[model samples]
Target: MIPSFLVPLMGGSDVSPSLLTFKSLCYFKCSMFFSPLGMVPVSALVGFGLFDRGFPVVGHCVEIEIPMLILFIVLSQYLKNFKTRQLPILERFALLISATVIWAYAHLLTASGAYKHRPELTQHSCRADKANLISSAPWIKIRYPLEWGAPTFDAGHAFGMMAVVLVSLIESTGAYKAAPRLASATPPPAHVLSRGVGWQGIGILLSGLFGTLTGSTVSVENVGLLGSTRVGSRRVIQISAGFMIFFSMLGKFGALFASIPFPIFAAAYCVLFGLVASQGLSFLQFTNMNSSRNFFVIGIALVLS
Candidate 1:
């Protein structure tokens, strides 16, 4: 299952979904603690796809999303073939480039008043100027531990989160296994896997202390990005973590990204998530599909899922 590792915000709301993937991560920081107490209902509504106002807005976004999806595919394929040692940046950051171009295109439409007379939902979602989030957001804000209030624990919530943690463990296993294969590295040994899971658990515990609703998990979309860009550098992830830490405190910076139209993000997910699913299926080639036992195992796994 593709875990919505973070809450899906409508002011809402993915690898080749990676174009805006990083942006969304940062956006999460803006409201990281805003609705901590409201998480259960919000998560339930999102899981059920029952957003009262967001559904119509999301529908309006498809017009923008479809074109963005096409652009991602075209740019990714074109960059793959146009590789060169001196100009490798294009291929390494192809997803970002596609996202920027399409984002600008969407912004242009908003600036040109193309969405001016559209329905309110379309205007709210499709028009970049409508949100005015940047002006309203503080320039900088420091997030302190337990800033929302002292963390509370309940048996019901604890049990529900335990269920999510179990699923996250399974998802993390797939991501950890897949990442090395994509990067052309050996699979992780059991000890390394155990260490990774330990760190992830620590991260989750820290998120609770720091007032965020969710903990970190292996990002399947990022694994797909590694396969798509073919740039597997640990230093890159380290540098990004540094940036995430620094920019997360910049309230205006996070809010600016939070204002990005949801449809644009949806488009990116179409490409990145597809790559993730394709990569998962690619593993089947390594298995003995012809064997009855293998088929039975696959069938049972599918049914259970």
Candidate 2:
């Protein structure tokens, strides 16, 4: 489960999956809070069964998502001639088209049976040796201590973990703020923000319980996807979360996603990260950038970051 979260985080650290993943978390959170009953429908829609099998396509990472982007650009340009009322839907339609094209290419490659001859074509091809879903019970080797005992506490390790958690909180705060904006929604209320932070703490607790060395943090790439796709509905995000949990429980299902081609993900990142940058720039409007203090703060932060 930890690896599952970390895998996307690792991929996103270099690109923009962090935003995409964060957007998905917002969707999940919103759905759970406002539409708890929507879980069943969402689960059925985005279940692990969706990506059971697929062949890999061989190409430069950038090529995978470029055609989709081109399609979006062309569609956006064409839609400019339409009335304002129709423009929003048309823009969303263009995004949908882009997604369809990318999926079609992936499906085409898979259906072509290319992997039979070129196993390396798939991302994490080495995983073929592992079970699609881990069948062993997670607690098979677990045991409880026979007597009450005090364990030595290492202040250095405690402080290190605290530092990491603090950094994670800062990043998560930005993600929470950005997620709503990207979804075309208002910023979360104070209570909701507190809840989100509390959830992070809970996640860390669960990670420790599971013996994981590190804790989880929200992804920023998913948030970027919200801006690109303009799908801010919490119901959709809840469904995504459901899929993640469901897949983690089913080893084979999780493997299916792992098998996705790198180029396809990279292509999506190309579009998403652009939106993230644009969204970040939009924040400048609220600031008094003309002031020397503000200017230096922003400039130094940008350069250092």
Candidate 3:
């Protein structure tokens, strides 16, 4: 999964159309998809993660989340009457504009002299969640011993800790909803059903067994995007995938993306993530907010978010 802030940027790369297909399928595509203010929470958390965890950790975006997610979204289509929306023109327009800008920026960033450093992200071993798995709280001790070693499960080094698999699963689930929402539609693939989710569990175990598993197939924001957009065509998403594979081998391409100034990336992400947050809030509008429980829920959401 990409960091909440970085998603807007990293997502912009490759065949833009295909990228949308994949993101729309992500459990949550945009942090702001639910609340126009959601970016506040999304950005804050990611910013907090960056400071608390570090950049590589914050910038990390795993390709692994796609296959596993597509498998699930394909089956979600089976649930009937799950759709809602008047297809707000503004939301649709906003979603396209926001995603395009970020995608374009990603292409530009990689096009220039920036993407020259194509160090394989897979080669380096990182701490659990890259740094997010740890915190500053002195009393907060890590109970999982699996996190203590390097990721060389097959090479004598231990495979990644079990926690990575656990956390990644949760996040990817979230991503499935986020991506489509940003586009102002419900994801498609009518065969989608609860039974399909079983594939994800299988993936989780295999990742552990192989020690190469990383990234969440579902994330809150990634899925949120899909809930908003309703576009879930895997074939369309292949375009972006083609570019991504090429970029992986071409250091210059990836570096170009890494070139944009932090300020620019921040501003761009702020818009996208903020939109994502609003979508979340809009979804909440369906609930009875007058109740204290709901009131408290909204209140806490505002305070923390």
Candidate 4:
């Protein structure tokens, strides 16, 4: 039985092992063995049993979508060098605009019954699985309305969460350093780093209050996008965050946006994660591989991981 406290961390780690470290893995393994999170996966598996089977075509689309989009972006940028023809504007924002246009077109096609005969196409083209839930749910209800009396504190469980939080902190520190470099900005000031860590703790508290059961951390994916797009403006990040919060409050809008096809999301993730992994490897420039200590550490980490 998976411990409940460790479940979320395990879930996140499963999504991307590239972001974790040897120490984190050791901690996770120890936590898993101790079983601090408590049979969370059993409940989750039961919940998943209620959903329809996922489509293989959607999985295939996800696998190739990002690379294809990256290739398209690169080709479009390269073709811009042709002096004879005036090409349409193509930049980071332009790419997003084009994606929005395509998403809208897909929805239109779905609505117009273009895929009426292809049920799989319709299923894979967009998502709206949560729309019904959101529409039927009460807006102002507290997510966890009842308290199970006084909280029973378990030292082992608390330690597991603490270990995960420490791991998250280490990862966030690396992200903070990497994000600025990717954005072509100076490394964050000491106070800024402190504040960032502090805010992450606050976010964790808020998540618990909101019943998310997950801790917050910097996204390597977005940092990688900063590197790929060459856009480092903090205002852009703030605005995007604002939009997320705004949309999250609008259930229908959020559900609609969530309905974006897997292929589209996967394409973006592929490019972003690839860039992130590459950027992480680029950090090796500062390390002397010729040194046996450094070589063994790096070698063993890679092999073990």
C-alpha TM-scores of all predictions: 0.76, 0.58, 0.41, 0.63
Each prediction's Cα lDDT score? 0.60, 0.51, 0.37, 0.52
Model 2 ranges with Cα > 4 A deviation: 1-62, 68-157, 212-214
The pairs that clash in candidate 1 are 9-12, 14-17, 14-18, 15-18, 17-268
Task: Count residue pairs with overlapping backbones in model 3.
Answer: 108
Q: What local lDDT score does residue 104 receive in model 3, on the 0 to 100 scale?
A: 52
**Cα error, candidate 3, residue 79 (Å):** 37
Residue by residue across 142-174, what tens digits does model 2's lDDT show?
A: 323221232223445545666666556546655
State candidate 2's TM-score.
Answer: 0.58
Give one digit per residue, the lDDT tens place, for model 3 in 152-253: 222111123233433443333333334555555564232341222334544443343333335224433333334434555666457756876566555544
Worst 10 residues of 2 by lDDT: 46-55
Model 1 C-alpha lDDT per residue in residues 1-305, reported as the tens digit of each score? 11232322111011111212222333333333322122222222222222223233346776676777777777777655665666666667777887788788888888888987888977777877646788888888888765666444444555566566666655655566667766778766655665676677666655665667566677666776887788889999999999988888898888877877777766665555555555555566666667897667556654454
Q: How far off is residue 209 in model 3, in Å?
A: 10
TM-score of 1: 0.76
Worst 10 residues of 4 by lDDT: 35-44
Judged by whole-model lDDT over C-alpha atoms, candidate 3 comes out at 0.37
Clash pairs, candidate 4, are: 3-37, 3-38, 4-37, 4-38, 5-37, 66-267
**TM-score comparison, 1 vs 2, better candidate:** 1
lDDT score, residue 203, model 3?
42
